[model samples]
Target: MDPKTALPLNTSRNMPILGLGTWQLKDDTAGTIAAALELGYRLIDTAVDYGTQPGIGEGIRRSGVERSDFYLVTKVEETDDAYEATRAYLGELGLDYADLMLIHRPPSSGPGEDLWRGLIKAKEDGLTRDIGVSNYSTDRIDRLIDATGEVPAVNQIEWSPFGYSDDMLRYGREKNMVIQAYSPLTRGKRLDDTTLGEIAGKHGKSPAQVLIRWNLQRGTAAVPKANQRAHLEENIDVFDFELSEDDMARLDGLNERFSSLGRLPYA
Candidate 1:
């Protein structure tokens, strides 16, 4: 039940399901990233918009861990120069290539297909090992496939028991795209929910752990963030426990079609 064990990313390799989310995590980036690496987290998610790449880089350097041992992911923010910008940023981060690179969000100002072309190029040129989209809708996904003739390797979305989207998940699965759940803890809104609390009580765990376990059971990879050392440790501790089928059903019943952000056309 070691969390470091990577799950099947298809048959060729595995990806660690539980990862460290780097949103709004900066200033103490090196220290925090180093600490998390020391704590046994192999997957780290960051983005250009987060303004923490330098810190992440510093952390990685300080951690003294070999780059090949970690699954490093970053994103290209929606900007006029997304491709070049991402390349420059990664240069600053001092990594030759990222394990995964995503389109941070559907561009609001330009052709998403054009931006995707840049991502495809990055993948082809080996700047990124895998390229994908984030915050994309099913329609957007279809258009992307039509343009690129290849589905994204991963589609990161906001998924939680509170706001489950079976349609999106099903579509991503059909395409062999990994469904990565961001904000899987519901941004602290559902930590005190009666049902989640009940499940936590039964398992002697926290509500956050219950939610993460639910995501793992559903076969979705999750990146849950926590700045506190204790909280970070607690987040990855779910691998040792397995929820019962009945408990899984009860948690599944808690889906309310809720969304922290109003339903946007894109993810």
Candidate 2:
């Protein structure tokens, strides 16, 4: 797959198939983002909860890239007022509008019915161009649609070959929603798998590259976080080789429902 490929949203916009995720980035957030931008990364994924919005804004200023050229994604937590929180997030990012905003997770008390409304409101007010959800099960998403009469444009999830789910993939395809994959590298935990090693060796690629290629071939947007120059380069260098059907099948079978976040099944 081409590294420049973009996945269509339910809306008119298209999200870059690969993006830079800022979760634990701290003091180096601005430098890392600036470097990633220099490497031609056009999509940036962050959240108010990550406390990296300020750095992201600073990085964008330092990159000298045009705002319209790149995609910006941020999120509102389940506990916060989605609309107001979205406004605050924009203020932090020093942007007037975000390309996309997502509800960080399902609410503890409800199926995110109220939170969904807030996100929709933000979109209606032009605070965001598109809105979606993160860490939401299919059932919860259905309920949101039922309650708000709107389909989320994307669903961010903790997904990797080891944590694969056919049902989730099918759900995204059926809904015409992009599944933004976080931690596609397994956070450096499962890189030692013998099967993954074999596949990587056969293709003359690293295990991390193999994993990222798997996600890209499946059409899921993989946002692997990397602050170092080497990792930043390695993460986005998956466009050179293609994995065969057999290779994909082997990787798919590696799924043991593994999730570092202890996520439950997408019932």
Candidate 3:
């Protein structure tokens, strides 16, 4: 496996760094996912709320790839009965175990700890190989670890050139948690940024590609969503090229306080 292309999930195994995000890739999700698999995308990101689990499973089946070869991930949305609800929902996906599972959002209720404990149990029961949390604040992660005596294997957050959070990233690293970036493209807000455009010009790549490479260089696993076939292919074609130290520094200078989507503190 490619060293830069893989990430270690706790002490278990390495997961692919680039994954196909299925946030809004419905309707033709199965076909698209199948195409992505054929095109060599081994990591897939989905959520129970995405309503495409069945299609994802169908795509995986049709791809003719061994289940063990893919790194499958899904998230459980915050709900009053997140434990039982997530258990039932994942059961419907028909997978024996997921490579990674995360709480979609930090729970507002006091039972957030209970939900995490349930996920830990799921890991022990072989329902998931690794368990994590998404959109969690630094305080929340510290508190949970204190409460459960377990640190999350990963922490998925909205990260991009414009929305980089040094504090959260530092904390995750301090806890030995993998930081997975969900919107590494900044939702296309910085596609036309002058700095990225210049970097792309020098490298003969797209601005999006440059941004994705920036994420990789920063040591964060990124999953950028694209429903179009060409876009999907373009997103994963980032591995062939390498960014220079100067180029990386230029891109690093593009970091702003928050995403163009506005800052929403972790709940």
Candidate 4:
């Protein structure tokens, strides 16, 4: 698969099917990002809570890649003054606008109408090219659409064979929302699973590569985190092989609603 291959959005934007996730990457954020950029990563996922925005921006500059060559994503706090928070994060990123911005999670009360509205407002003002949500249930996603008269272009969630369900996958397909998979490697917890190991051996690939290929073959975007050059290369080297139908089915059977993030209210 092309490293830059992307899925179409409800808006006039397109998102790369693969991205580099920046959770807990603050210490060497700039160096890591700059290296990944050189390694052909176009989509870079970060959040305000990650506290790596400044380093990410510096990495983009340090890479000497044109701003237009990259697709940037960031998330906002649910309780944040959404629009203003997004704007401030943009300043921290040293970018005029983000390619995508998402509500980190649905707030505890109400339907998060205000948060959605603020994100929409940010998009309208060109603070972001697109707006979406993360860790949202199907009903919560519907509520946002019903309230805003606009469907999110992407719904990001913790997705892996172990953490995702077929129903959620189908729902995203029905809604035409690209389901961006985070923690697709399950934070290295499931890499040692027997099923993953068997499949990896057959493909002469690492379990991590097998997991990522599963996501790409399923048509959802994946953002796997890797800080070292070798790990980054290994993560992106998954495009060379295709998983068979039987392999896909075997992996799908591993779903157990498990999440490394613990029990999410929406999950």
Q: Could you give candidate 3's per-residue lDDT for residues 40-94 as a string of tens digits? A: 8888999977887888888888898897888888887777354565567567666
In lDDT terms, which candidate is top? 4
Per-residue lDDT of 164-265 in model 2, one digit per residue for the tens?
A: 678889999999989988888888899999999999999998999999899998999999988778988998898989999999999999998888677634
> What TM-scores do the predictions have?
0.94, 0.97, 0.93, 0.98
Ranking by TM-score: 4, 2, 1, 3
- Give Cα distance to truth, residue 266, candidate 4, Å: 3.9
Ranking by lDDT: 4, 2, 1, 3
Whole-model lDDT per candidate: 0.82, 0.89, 0.80, 0.91
For candidate 4, what is the lDDT?
0.91
Segments of candidate 3 deviating more than 4 angstroms: 1-4, 80-83, 264-267
What TM-score does model 1 achieve against the real structure? 0.94
Please give, for residues 1-267, the per-residue lDDT of candidate 1 as tens digits: 567766565325567788999887854888989999999999999987787888889899999999888888888877736568668878868898888888888877643887788888887787887877788888888888898786787888888888778888788778877888888888788899998899899999999999899988888889998788888899989987889999998988887776766653443
Q: How accurate is candidate 2 locally (lDDT)?
A: 0.89
Off-target runs (Cα >4 Å) in candidate 4 are none
- Please report the candidate that would top TM-score against the real structure: 4
lDDT of 4 by residue, 1-267 (tens): 789898998777799999999998866999999999999999999998888899999999999999889999999897899999998999999999999999988888966889999999999998999999899998999999999898889988999999786777888888888899999999998899999999999999999999999999999999999987888999999889999999999999998888888854356
RMSD versus native structure for model 3:
2.0
